[model samples]
Target: MSNSRSTKLHVAMFPWFAFGHITPYLHLSNNLAERGHRVSFLLPKGAQAKITPGAETASDVPFPLHGHLCIAFDQTQDQVQTILSSLKPDFIFFDFSLWMPALAHQIGSKAIYYSVITPVAQALKVPTKQKLEDMTLEDFMQLPPGYPSPSVRIKSKAFEIAQLKVVAEDLGTGMSIYVRITSSMIWSDAMAFRTYHEVEGPYCDYLRKHYAKPVLLTGPVLPETLATKLDEKWTNWLCNFKQGTVVYCAFGSQNKLQKDQFQELLLGFKLCRQPFLVALSTPDGCATIEEAFPEGFQESVKGRGWVYGGWVPQTLILEHPSIGCSVTHCGYGSMWESLFSDCQIVCVPYLGDQILGARLMVEELKVAVEVEREDNGWISKESLSKAIISVMDKDSEIAGLVKYNHAKLKEELTSEGMQERYLDTFIQNLQGLLD
Candidate 1:
């Protein structure tokens, strides 16, 4: 608690290449730096370019891990080893991609695996490379004993390469997600997570029981300030709407939709009849907006619909009083941001972990509603519309309950010392690694 007694560590950080992974790593780095620890954040040159606006990006890591996806991760091994040799930090906190504990072994430095996903995710991640290689869709359906039910049962059709990538089978090559994660359990000096015990205590216990390691939490690692101001045009646009009368829909930077799915979302928004702002990104290999936007769609909803093709300050939009509901992909970052703003969620999860997260928010946390999917898990426009109307209806008891739950969670998240206590525990664990 006292500055003089704090153990200052020279910490090195390397997160996987994605905004969701990068932002939380930065938050931890900033927290460390603020507490008098020395942190050197290592990022591929490409990721360095995409660091969020206003985040401090002046770091010593300049090498680019070139190529796409798993190829890029494959290429970072030697570069990261070189970084470890050069920086000689007390401990290295790296993504679970490269068997980093082995690299740290060669360099005589300790490695800590830092997970940016949820505790349930970590609990369900395969335990070995062999198991990952052998796993089938049915294997996924057969949940481990004590695994949280309903939330953990992923639809079979959702089992695909995109989902595999999250679990660790990259491009049909490279290490499996189990290997990336469990390698940390076996080799890393410790593990750190972006969660609190209160929220996922049971899963956290499950992980420790199974993995046999010190699992440290970082307590959500929420942004200390949501300072990005809304653009004047957006602010002026939203001003005309009545309080809690807007739907704010964003499906993260990565989860792009097919043209048909995109069209269905538009129709759903229209059916709800709330003034809305929707932001979408074209996924790799997806058609551009010019090819995808429906004919007369924009013109028909001209007065009420605002569609942004690229990035927007999502936190600012969610915080606005006009935003009553959010339809999101349930990525950890977006999930927390929406929860932080106390916005009711209409979940349309588009990825693996997202499927689990959406289920938790809806079935367990009771702060969100799920869009109905076909038996094979395809999202329908009717399902989307039904979910939106359910959440947006002012007199609905479900709407009132969701809002109450969101407010309660927000208070717990922002409570003084909740995050700081977790940080202290993590730092103390890092010190233990040194001892």
Candidate 2:
């Protein structure tokens, strides 16, 4: 490892083909760039347009077609290699591209498997020698050996376990998702996650011992500043409501719900009887959010609820004083955003990693409440309403406790020099890798 303090390394960013993945890579790139490190970011043209323009990500693609996207992403390997050859960067930071290590080696660059997902999720689903095709629900139900937290175990829920199995299956790619992620870690020069040790230290340490490799932390990778403002229409609407009175619900660009569930979620907001805004993709079989609305839903919630099918300024909205509570799908990026905001959090997770993230929030951190799901993984309007009301109600004890805890933790995380210190140490470690 190099001890030189003045070395500034050129790093390449090639994340998986999802905005959830790409956006974090960009945040890290911005951080590196601010430190005078050269960064070359590579992504598909469609992805590039979405970040710059307002187009949604490939995550909005239907679930059945995700495999095709993976196949296309893999086909870019040769193109990526050619680009790397020309750049000759000192380090390549990537995730989901299991083939990146060899390509980095070809160019004499160190490959860093920089995971945007939580280490708790990775620790629970640690890679094993067993074939993914043969792994059963029982296999996923059992916590991996030496898992850091007993609280983060997979529930006996069939839907959750089934989702895990699906993740382990080949999604049009030749390799299973599990193999793609684990193999990347196994072959990379080092492993890094977009998390701080204060929150996820045990899990990070466990992964280090399990993989026998350097594990680095990037301290949440939040942007230091924002360049944009909330849309005028939203600002106008939210101003009519008092501070901490409106509930905001968004399940991210991905995760289009079933038509039935879509209406149920709307009904949940109506039951809460709070002024609210919901941003979501059109549900399956529905062309617009209005088409999927439950009968009388519009007339009932009339002026109190607004549902939009396009993207809204989420980070800005969360920062709005009127947004008292947020109902999220617990995606990693959203999790960080919610943690940094003052809003009370209610989680309705739809994926494996999201489920684990929700557990980390609700169970481990005690900073949020999770909407209960049925045995088949269906979330009910009543459950959603209950979760939101529990947090939004001023008189509720649980609400006060979670709010206090969340505020304390948020202060610690965003304290002056916290993110800067993490980035500085991370850069020092990168220089060491070149030795």
Candidate 3:
């Protein structure tokens, strides 16, 4: 063990461009610095503002680690060494595009990557044999004329055993070079995750026994993130809404939908007659949304909902009592936020990890429901309306059950027993480095 008093780690954090990645990496950096470690966050220039004002930032922020610490380049094997040669930090914690084996061989640095969501949920997505890489144009174009995609043959058959083997092997080989990873199981790491062990315990157990990485979760890092005065203004609008009264809807940044799907969601929300706040980008192939809306649709819902063209304060809004339920793209960050809040989730996950998060929310968590997705990837009006009503016009049974479950999870969140145990573990890990 490095002497607690003798060694001080100069740690670097590299997180992806998105807010999800940026926010937590900042939090971890902050935590390490508070603990007396030297820390610098490596990020694209544009995101400098994402770091809070008055927060410590290294003046020699840009330094050659392996070569020159360049973050924007498509993460490749060569860059890792370039970073190591320069900064030579005791450790580097990365959140995305981590090709571990290459990094370790390039520089014998302890490189750790944080999985912000459940890695077990991720391992679940490892392709089963029988999965095809891409659907032919024919399969892609077909609308799920009648049923959900998972119920259909295409998605379920994805991931053959052979494919799973290859993906697993690829990951395992990376561990051979590095010390694997030391953290995951996001919620258990965070006191904020109110999950029942009875349901997800098997998953948590699988991770602990097999993966061997300590499940290190800090409490939900509040994405109460901001950039400038513009963000402060936007937050003001959110502040105006009543707690648990507003429907907070946002499809995460990458999952841009085509015009039809966007219109369908608008029309469905209009049909539901509830107050909705939506954060959106223009749908695919359309520069503006004016052409997509149904006639009189915009005027009709004008006073009832707010549709902002860009980003929303996702984490802060979700915690608001006025924002009762979330309509999400099922992004990993959003999923954990909703789970941490123990709020209602309405999933319309667009792709990749979103779909994986969707399956867990629908099949396991039982706190949310899925919005229908046609093969064409359009979420139709009927499906949207049906889902809206399912959560909005709630009966005594569901509301009661949701409350009960939320309460149980809330207990876990506030439980001194759990909090002490987790914090003790965190402190111990740091202490171990010293011992």
Runs of candidate 3 with Cα error greater than 4 angstroms are: 1-8, 49-80, 95-102, 105-108, 125-201, 212-215, 223-243, 289-291, 375-377, 416-424, 430-435
> What tens digits encode model 2's per-residue C-alpha lDDT throughout 176-218?
7888888899999999999989888888998898799999998
**For model 1, how does the per-residue alpha-carbon lDDT over 372-431 read when each residue is reduced to its tens digit?**
776555676677888988888878999888888878977987788877888887788778
Task: Name model 1 segments beyond 4 Å from true.
Answer: 1-5, 52-68, 125-147, 150-170, 283-291
**Cα TM-score per model:** 0.88, 0.93, 0.70
Which lDDT value does model 2 have at 390?
97
Question: Which candidate leads in lDDT?
Answer: 2
Count of residue pairs whose backbone atoms collide, per candidate: 3, 0, 30
lDDT of each: 0.74, 0.84, 0.54
User: Which window of 10 residues has the lowest lDDT sum in candidate 3?
Assistant: 58-67
Better of 2 and 3 by lDDT: 2
Error of 3 at 46 (Å): 3.9
Best TM-score goes to which candidate? 2
lDDT, candidate 3, at 115: 56
Compared with the true structure, model 2 gives a TM-score of 0.93
